[model samples]
Every structure is written in structure tokens, then in C-alpha cells.
Target: MSGIVEVAAAVMLRANGTEFLLAQRPVGKVYAGYWEFPGGKVEPGESVRQALIRELQEELGITVTECSPWLTRQFTYPHATVRLNFWRATAWTGEIGITAPLEHSAVEWQACGTAATVAPILPANDPILKALALPTTMAITMAESEGVERQLERLEQALQQGLRLIQVRDKGWPPARRLAFAEAVTRLAQAHGALVVINDDAEIARQAGADGLHLSSGQLAACTSRPDFTWVGASCHSAEEIARAGELGLDYALLGPVLPTPSHPESSGLGWPEFGRRLNSNRLPVFALGGMKNELLTAAQNHGAHGIALMRGW
Candidate 1:
């Protein structure tokens, strides 16, 4: 850790909040032509948030109005090791008036979840791009309560409304019924260019052509290796479980009971403060689960959640 430099980086979003800015390193700096999230090294007395705000103001001439901790990654370069703390700046003030005063040579906004025309990106940026591509809301199925036919109708409506990530968790059904339903959901999801994850069943997920598998905490603990899927995530209730999810190289994790719910009325929820504590400095993108509504996305993001996972609200 001695030579590891701490740096703060910003994934600055435009007014639409879907595209993010990437800057080219200046002429004399390391990787001069390489593109990266705009930021600078943290000063001796600065917290990550403080450094982020300062760096963005200096580099972009914009005051960050709303930002949140996003990702933490460490990479080794020939000169030294660096731990890059990334934040997603969803709102800002002021214009990016001129480039002469900025340290970067050039900057460009690229749409998330798409290939960038910008070339020769920094080696460490591949994962960052993937993380950026992940949708901010994950919809979990509640078909058992809603009834399969009614749920399907609701799903189609949600899909048309731009709900892209889904989790099919029809545990009340028998194995055959679950598999059949999973297949139906997968087909519908694929038609709309959406991704689906089958909950708690790798085989069913695979058979249904799901994009990934979502493991229950019990399943996550019992597994020795990540299942074969394009995306794999787990339900985590504790800090240790979150760390374990990272160790398993999972794409994301859902941490929750962030608020009390009708389904689990006896259980107390981890208030936003506790939710923030559990997710502090997490390397893996995490979703706030349980008692979530669509309007709470900002609240979730402010507390370091990658997004929210909800059963009722899309």
C-alpha cells in the first residue's frame, strides 16, 4: 500500500444523465493520448469526495451539484500503484467554456452501454465501461402474488416504458411451472432488448436463455465458483457477504431491507444511514433492495448504491 496513490475520478453525466464524459490526458502526462474519466490525484488532507469536487472544478470549470461514490479500482502502473475512486456526477453547474485552462487535451461525451469511437482507452477502463453500461433499475418479479397472466401483461407495459433489467423469481411455482414461466419471461425480455436473470436456479436460467443467474444468500455461500453466465449476482445482507460477492467476481450485489416492507413486516429495515455504512467503499456495484420505489433512485444513488432493485415498483 505504500506506493499506492489515491486518486479521485469523475464520471460526469450530461443533462440527460445517460452519457458520460471522458478526457484525453494532456500532452506531457502519462498516457498522453489515452482517454479516461476526468480527475486528479487526491491531496494529502482531502477526502475522496472533497478531492472529486476540487478536481472537477479545476479541470472542467463546473461545480458538481450532485454526485455519489460509484466504483473503486486499483491498478499498477510502471511508475506506481493507484487506487482510483470514481463518482457519478449527475448534476453540475457552469459551462465547460474553454479547454485551454483544462489539463486534458480533449473531451467527449459517450452514450452509456455502447462502444466508444474513442480509441486506445487506458487499460484499466474496460471494467469501468462495463459498469457504466449497467442499468440503474432492476425489476424483480412478483408474479406469484399478481398471477402469471396479469404479471405478464404488467411486464409488457413496463418493458414498453423502458425497464431493461429483470429478475424472474417465481418461487411459489413448481419446478416445471417455474421453468416454463422463466422461458416465457426470457422470450418477452429478449424481444425488447432486455436482460433477464433467473433467481436461484442456474439450470433453469440457462435453459431459459437468461442473461444471468441470481443466487440467494444460501446459494451464494454454498457455491465455490461463479456459475457460467454472462452476469452473476448475489443477495448479500452483511458486509462480509458483499466482500464475498466481490471475491467471486460477481457483476453486482443486492443489499437490503433498506426499508420496512409489507412482505416482511416483522423485520426491521436498515435505514438509509445504515445502508450507506454497509456499502461504503464497495468495489462491486450494489443495488438497494426491499421496500424500494422508483422515486427513491436518487436517494439510493446518494448513499453509494449503483441503483435500486424493486419488486413492486418499476
Candidate 2:
């Protein structure tokens, strides 16, 4: 077998970040006519970021001004094995299509949180498309500390403010109370077109009609199979845990204590550098958990987080 090919793929987004660019492979390329994210093979000795900057400029005529490591996926094709390093590009210079030579036959912007309008997307990119649809903020319920009624009121307010993803986490509560709370959260979230996942309780998740399940670290380690849900995620505090989550085919993982939190005051958090290092080249989207607030989203993204998962800040 030949050596694996390293490629840098860009998820170039519009200013609002609700859309990303996709290009139709030009004739004569392997997958010609099929659509894929705009990018190219990484040359020897070139870092993925460097390749991303060069590829976007060459293929789309835009100089990428901002980008971050997102996910890495490997695929084996008839022709070769490829390791695709995906980056999220949010800012750039030069107008697409008009500013530079068009390397592909065509290009179009795809809206996030929706099915692709373009046909025949490259097979390796199907999972990436799904990951892109996940919202950047995850609210973990704190009904254990706050009263159930108060938490429900806050959840409704948050939904009104455009919160689209939530985790119903009240492990301290009795099973009956937890189930009732999860049911109420699911109902409110559904009304706002949001998704609700029950923490560490598959029965409650199903019983409450939650959209998915969120596993605690202990539950994640004990699982032998992916749970049956539309979306499944886990809490991960280490690289090994994150890898396990990916191996289990989870939709996402929450990794951190990126900053010190009141809940874990005795332990110092993994600062941004360590968090970035642990997250490098991860296959699935990961949310930075613990001490995260609305304003920390950009900082978290810069350190390779898909988004931030909050308990109190949300």
C-alpha cells in the first residue's frame, strides 16, 4: 500500500458563520463533478495551517485571515488513503470567484443546520456535514442546585434568546424528579426547535422524549456500544476519553475545565494551551466545559473547541 496522503480542508464560513463554501471538483480530478470543501493536499514539511492558507488562495483566490483546527478524518479510497485535516475559516480577504482563478468548475455557499442542497457530496465529507450542523453553545441544566421551577423558567428564557442545544443534568435529583424535569425541558426545547439530551440516563432520555444522550465520564467508559439516539455525546477530561468517545461514534464530546470553576475550585483548570494540545487532530466536535460564558466562545474556538458548554453562564 502507498503512503497516506495528508490534506488540508477548509470549512470557510461567511461573516455571519451560518454558511460555508463547497466546491465542485473540476474535470480530470478523482471524484470529478462531486462537491467537497475547498482545499488541497498538504505538501511535505508544510503544516496544515500553511497548506490551508495556500490552498484557499490558490483554489478560491481568498487569503484566509482567521482559521482554527477543527477535526481530522481518515478515509481509504480505491486510489489512496487520505488524512483530512479540517479547519474552520471565519475571516478572509478577497472576493471569492471574482478575485482569483477558479480552480474548480463551480463553488457555492451551504447553510449550516440544514441538508446540503448540492448533490453528490464527497463520501468522506458526510460526517463533517453533520458535525457542522451542531450548534456552538450547549447549556447543561443545573436544576440540582437551582430549583426545578427556576431552572425551567431560565431554560425558556434561554430558548427565547436563541439557545438551540441543551443537556438535562440533574444527577443529584431523585429518578422521578429527574425524569419529570427532563420531560419539561424536552417540551420547552421542542417548542423552540431546540434539542435536549439527558445526562447519563438512557431510560430517562427515551422516557422523556429527549433528542439524545450525554454520557458522564464513568458512563462513557462503561459503554460498549453507541446508544440509540439521534445525537450522543460524552463528558471527556482527557485525550484518552475523547478518543473513546470518537471510537464509540458519538456526535460530540465535552472536554474541559478550560478555566477554573466554582464547582471544581480546588483543582486548577487546563489552561488554553493544554486544552488545545489535548484537542489537536480530534475526529469529533468538542465543547469546552467548565467556567465558560458567552464571551469566552471566541477564545474557546481559537483553542480548537467546537464551542462552549455552560452550566451557570448559559
CA lDDT, every prediction? Answer: 0.89, 0.93
- TM-scores of the candidates in the order shown: 0.95, 0.98
Q: Candidate 1 on 25-63: residue-level lDDT in tens?
A: 888888889999998899998999889989988988878
Residue-by-residue lDDT tens digits, candidate 2, 212-247: 999999999999999999999999999999999999
Q: Look at candidate 1 and tell me the lDDT of residue 230.
A: 88
Report how far off residue 295 is in candidate 2 (Å).
Answer: 0.7
**Clash pairs (backbone) in predicted model 1:** none
